[model samples]
Target: MNGIDITVSTRLIQGLTNLSLGHVIMILVGGVLIYLAIAKEYEPVLLLPIGIGAILANIPVTGMTEPDGVFGILYNIGIKNELFPLLIFIGVGAMCDFGPLLERPYTVLLGAAAQFGIFGTLMLATLMGFKINDAAAIGIIGSADGPTSIYVAAALAPDLLAPIAVAAYSYMSLVPIIQPPIIKALTTEAERAVPMPYTNNQPVSKWLKIVFPIVVTLVCGLIAPLSAPLIGMLMLGNLLREAGVVPRLSNTAQNELINIVTLFLGLTIGSTMTAGKFLQWETLGILGMGLVAFALDTVAGLSFGKALSILTRGKVNPLIGACGISAFPMSARVISRLGLEANPNNFLIMHAMASNTAGQIGSVMAGGAILALLAR
Candidate 1:
């Protein structure tokens, strides 16, 4: 009976014995993520699962990170071959409404301009002694698009995936907090007050919506064959949304598919944040540089918006340029709110949505461009 008691006690203490300072720190980090999600309402869907995964990963003897374990299996099947991010893109594309973008074609330029941060940060990362591949992956965090960041990092710098993903999603949630001050500092009151015309009178044709995806896929694939998987899947989702006859398919892609994929992807990514990998000077550098990348993207977009406002003789609201980050409705909403705050008559939501959607495509293009240039 005493032997049995001792054996049970030893087994119970095994986890405590193996726990390290690093594990404690990581667990606390996980708790912080959870707090942020629940209390701050910062991307609860994504962060909650991630936080739970991180806590589970730190616990000793769970066997969850083993070769055939859940994390390992998810990592191999979804992340290793770049399947999950691509799947998520399909859902994102389905959720995107390209009508505004089609109506205001010039906003695509804002999206393109926003992508300058990815390259700018890449050069800086290389100068900071990151390998070309790692720098490229790290630079992609500037895309401000989580799936793009994940897709690029998974391909180029799997080791840095956890930090990159966390930075990407965290900053995305903080768009309202991070972008406003920059937008205010960059533009004058007159610029922010500038009102642009929005015409819902001329609805984009159904045919155009359906055709845009196909043409984009064809052109983008040809220009960057390496991006075919990324762009193709995205366009496919958009096509499903636009097809009009496939509501079931589109709804499934938008809701069920995306939700499931996000859960698994976030958790799997969190599981990778083992203390051995996460607690390092390099991890700190990646986090800092990611903020730099995000700021650069916003700055570039605003600068271009200012230029466009100048060239167009105030016909374009420079404030809309801030929407060119790929945080979707959030960035658009931020720009719209800022516009309203500056000038109540200024209704910039549609215009901002145009730029926001353009940013989405631009981010994917930027990722494809990186893959094309460096993944070889």
Candidate 2:
């Protein structure tokens, strides 16, 4: 005590001593996230790291998120600069097989229809008293794409980032549970039993595959210049994968690059979940609107599918429409399962996948549209 000041209430020595009710609640929230990842096996890759980050950030004096700290460095490098989501999109494009969407071009309509959720939720948010930009950020959760939600929120409503990210990723993880009941309630048993066989198993030519990504990038960029960052990165990754000239780069993008970005992104996003920011009326509103957006996406998709089925005189399975919500393989598999349950031999995976992938593209484009409008 002769040479140094010793304060009993200093944060460094007061971890548990300074624990408040808010900190306790945040700790439990972090535990719940970890439990969901481990026990329920829900989005384990992202959730586990985010859960740990949440605990670390909420600790009284860890300084993990201080300006010079690890979390802060990660946030500035990744989330604040808007690099992580684009990086993840590269991986997504690398892993994507667009042949299905190419084969069934009409399914693009389902993808387009599903995007109504984004706009619908935006309007609702405005009515609920959110600022226009914040509403735009919150509504993008309807895209059902975590990266897109993050990208848009980072630009339009950085303050709402934590709740929006949590809501978007959580709903994406629960796609299997949330989609089925809504699908069942929307479709007739007979509609579910209808078969839409996929006879096109032909491989796309290497030249067409190479050209596709380039064409898509140009078209999306021309139509929505604001979307170029997101869409251009996505198509660049796909082009690398399909060009047959950069297998090494494509492989790196899909695996190591994506994985590293994911880890840092999760931790940085979780840092924003400190109790003071997360437990607010706005957070609740975002969570609620996020659910509404998801439901509307599903309903809209199913409605479009039903109409297509009627137009085609039962040759098309209405269930495939429900796959057009950007949930990718999960939504595709759900529709396929429902088809099989209705008729043991009813094979609809290819059909559903066609729409699912298109929905992915549609979501990117929708995010671009929102960005474009907000820019003006």
Candidate 3:
């Protein structure tokens, strides 16, 4: 009887001791993520799943995130193989509406200009002692193009994926707060109040819409084969939307497919945030560099906008230029709101979108360029 009691006690003690310090750290990280999601409302859809995954993975003796466990299986099946990011691209493509950009082809340049953040941040990171490839990966977080950031980071600096992704999404959510001050500071009251004529006459034909995605895929792929997967998937999603006969497919890709994959992707990414790998000096550096990249992108884009405003004889609002950071409709909306505040009649949404979309495509191109330049 005493032997039985001793055996049970020994098993309990071994179980308690088996709880590793790494698990404890992971739990704390999970708690932080939870607080950010719940209290801070930071990308709750993704962060909530991520936080839960972190907690689950860190639970001692759960084995849920180990090589043979459930989360591990999911991670190996998707993230490890780069399946999740590409799949998520399809969803992104389906949901994106290129009408505003297509109507104003000139906006493409704005998108390209906004990409300055990626390259600029890359250089800064390299100067700060990061490896060329890792620096390039970290720099992409400023693009505000989440998938592109993920795709590049996964390929070049998979180890830094968690922090890079968190930073990218977090900053993206904060665009409303971050961009407004910069836009207001850079543009004069007159510049912000400038009224631009609206145009509804630009008609994008179905043929051009169809051709747009195909052309972009070919051009980007030809330029950087490494970006082929990302560009290809994105274009495919766009193609489905433009094809005009695949409403069902487009709906599924945009909603159901995206929702399901987001859950898995978020959790798998969170699993990578194990304490040993994430709690490091380099992670903090990446975060700092990401902010630098975002600030520079806004500055470069606004400078260009200011130049355009001067050249266009005040026909262009410099505030619209700040939308070039690729935060999608959010940046565009912020510009429009500020425009209204400066002049109640000013509607910069459409104009801002041109630059906003341009920032998106430009960000991807820049990502490819960085990959080409550094990954080789």
Candidate 4:
């Protein structure tokens, strides 16, 4: 009886003995993410799964992150091959309405100009002693596009993906909080009050809608060959939406497909946040630098918008320029709200959406350029 009791005690206490402070800390961190998701509603779809994965990853002797474990297999099948982000882009493309951009063609320049933050942060990261590849991955956080950030980081700096992913999504959600101050600080009362009436109500050409995505894919692929996969998938999704012939496929891409992929991607990314990999000084640096990258992108966009306003003699509202990041309709809505606050009659959602859509294409191009130049 005594011998049996000793054996049972040892076996039962094994897990407790193996537990470490790091694991406890990581679990607590996961709890925080979960709390934020549930209480604050910040990216609940991704953050909730990410938080759960983080907790599971830190459990002693689970082997969930082992090479043959579920997370490991998912990571290899979905993330390592870069399949998940591309698929998400298809859904994003399907959901996007390019009519706003087509009607206001010049907003494309705002998107291109917004990419300056990416390059600017790249230089800054390089100067701060990071490798060129890591620097490039870090710079892409400025794009404010989570999937692009993940795609670039996984290819260039797989080790840094955890923090980069967190930063990208967290900051993307905080666009309303982060961008408003910058936009206000950069523009004066008159600039904020500037209103551009939406007088263009002509129907867009159906043929142009069908052909636009094809032309964009071809041109972008020729310009940056590596970006072909990312842009091609995006264009394909948009074509499905615009082609008006594949309602079932388009609906699937927009709804079921994206939701499933997002769940898997979030879980896999979170599982990578193990104590050994995630709890480091470098993680702090990545988070800090990511905020800077976002701020820089906003400043660059707003500056270009102001300049464009000056060149056009105030016909173009500078507020639309701030929507140039890939945060999409959130940024556009922010601009619209601010515009209305400045002047009750100001309606900028249409104009802001034009710039927002352009930013989506711009972010993908920037990611492709990085891959083209840096990928081994």
Candidate 5:
């Protein structure tokens, strides 16, 4: 009996001795991600699965993440090959309605202007000692465009992709909390209340809608070939949506396909967040810089909006500038709410949508530009 007890104790000691600190830290990080997803409602669709994957990846005996594990297979199939991001873009494009942007082509500039955050943040990160490629990856987080951030980060700084993606999605969801204060500070109550008359002057032709995605894809591809895969997939999805003859295909892209791919993407991303990689001083710094990037983006967008107001002789509500952060209809809705608060009679949703959609396209172009500049 004593001999048996001694053998059992030896085995337990050996097991404990094999445990790695990195694994423990990763498990804790996974727990934190799960809590954030469930309690804070922070990108639950992605974060929850990612959190689970992180937990699974860090288990001591599970060499699953090492060579033959399910996650290892997933990582190889989707992420390493760059299949998932492109697939997700298909869904994003299919779901996106370009009508708002098409109705006011001028608003595309607002989107373009908002991309200042990505480049500006890149320069700032470089000043902070990050290499150019790493800075570019980190900077894209400010665009509040999750997939584009993921694409750029994966291409330029795969090591930093996990944290950058988390930060981008987190900030995107928090747009309501983040943007209002900036908007209020920049514009007085009267400026927020300024109501612009909506003109039904432009009707988006079906042909225009069909051609818009194709033209953008061609133009962006010619300028930044690296972005072609992302842009092509995105445009293909949009074409399906606008063609009016592929409801089934569009529905699959928007629903079943997207749902399936998001699961794999989230899990694969989480697998990359092992404690060995994530529990570093650089991770904290990246988080901090991400917030700075977000704030600067809001400043740039709102400042441009203020300038547009001046250009339009105050007919344009400067508050709509905050919508240029690419948080989509949420940012637009926030602008409309603030406008109503300042003056119950004011409605800026349509105008805000124009800038909001513009921000989306602008973010993609900015991501492409950064890839072109840095990947070289």
Candidate 6:
């Protein structure tokens, strides 16, 4: 009986039931992601869960993402149905202070100008022989908005979602390393030194704050009905913040609610990066285009800023223009720091934040346009 039990156990560990080469490779990938998250301190909140999920997913015959499994349930309920990303948007909206964007309307123009990277990359992807929908999904990495990227890819090209998402988040976390070099290469010392004073001295009436989101929702809904869910959820979150009647709800949305969704979001996105899905020559192309897209966005944003600086008699620093991607305060901080480096007294955070906020809206708006044109 003992011998028979040993034989049965041996058979259990054999065959495809055990680790395959692909599974091993994927586990290693998962480990690398975890290492980056822990050791390098890169996007730890998202990356940690993602790495753990990837490893869990690659185990042989685990059925962890099967119809009834935790991952499967998460994907079906959150990602596949496109609910979690929108919920996270609510959190994002709640955290943002749009006063800066409101103060400087022209920075909205900088936000619009920076979006050329999306289309420019689309053209490049087309020339590389990607299908139109595939190219559109790939091009949106330039928007530097991971949730938006995931939404577009899930709709237009679900197959490319893994690489597109990984690329988007990776670049987002590397903003400090990537953006400064581009800004420096594009601007002269004098241009960087140009101080952009906070011009919006008028107090933002609380009434206008409440009204702004409602107006934006109506406009976005009319122009791009498909984007209504995205725009609506985002506006609702902002309304919760600006309305000031529900501090309890606002705090919940900003903290606990968003935190939970983000953990699931990261894990689900990572699970999609199985070896079979991610290991491809096409994946390489997507990664390459992602980098190019970000670089182009920075360059285009800075160029527009320089034009504004010239037009406004150096009153607008070109450094603020570099903040015209959807990376939020990080991008703004980069430009502000660069400005300070050029001159100790050049405090440009509020000015750069104006463009950064505008970029967030511009990115979502651009996503709306894509949905209108591409979604059938």
Tell me each candidate's TM-score. 0.97, 0.96, 0.93, 0.97, 0.93, 0.95
lDDT by residue for model 1 over 1-376, one digit each (tens)? 9999999999999999899999999999999999999999989988998898899999988889887999999999999899999999999999999999999889988998988889999999999999999999999999999999999999999999999999999988999998999889888888899888766678999999999999999988998888888889999999999999999999999999999999999999999999999999999999888888888888999999999999998899988887887888899999999999989999999999999999998889999999989986
Q: What digit string (tens of lDDT, one per residue) describes model 3 on residues 1-376?
A: 9999998897778746777887788788888888999999988878888888888777766678788998889878887777887898898888777887888776777777777888889888888999888998899998897777887888788899988988888888788888888777777788889987776776678888889999999998998877778778988999999998999999899998888998998898888787778879998998888888888888888888888878878777888778888887788998889999999999888888778877767777787777777664
How much lDDT does each candidate structure score? 0.92, 0.88, 0.83, 0.92, 0.85, 0.86
Estimate the TM-score for candidate 3: 0.93
Those runs of model 5 whose alpha carbons end farther than 4 Å from true positions after fitting are 1-17, 201-203
Global Cα lDDT for candidate 4? 0.92
Q: Mind giving the per-residue lDDT tens digits that candidate 4 earns over 1-376?
A: 9999998998788767878999999999899999989999888888999999999999878788998999999999998999999999999999999898999899998998888878889999999988999889999999899899999999999999989998999888888999999889989878989989878799789888889999999999999998999899999999999999999999999999999999999999999999999999989888988988888888999999999999999999998988899887788999999999999999989999999999999999999999999998
Q: Is candidate 5 or 6 superior in TM-score?
A: 6
Q: What's the distance in Å from true for residue 148, model 2? A: 0.4
Error of 3 at 31 (Å): 2.2
What residue pairs clash in candidate 3, if any at all? 111-358, 111-359
Q: Which 10-residue window in model 1 sums to the lowest lDDT? A: 193-202
Give residue 244's error in model 3 in angstroms: 1.6
Candidate 3 lDDT (Cα, 0 to 1): 0.83
State the lDDT at 242 in candidate 3: 92
List model 2 lDDT by residue over 1-376, tens digit each: 7335556446447898878888888878888989998999888778878888888889987888887899988888889889999999999999888887778879878888888889999999999999999999989999999999999999999989988998898899999998999989988888899978767778767788788889889998999988898989999899989988889999999999889988888888888888889988899999999988988899988888889988988788888888888987888999999999999999998888889988888899999999989944
Candidate 5 lDDT over 158-251, as tens digits, reads 9998899888887887888888897788779988899977787667899999999999999989988877888888889999999999999999
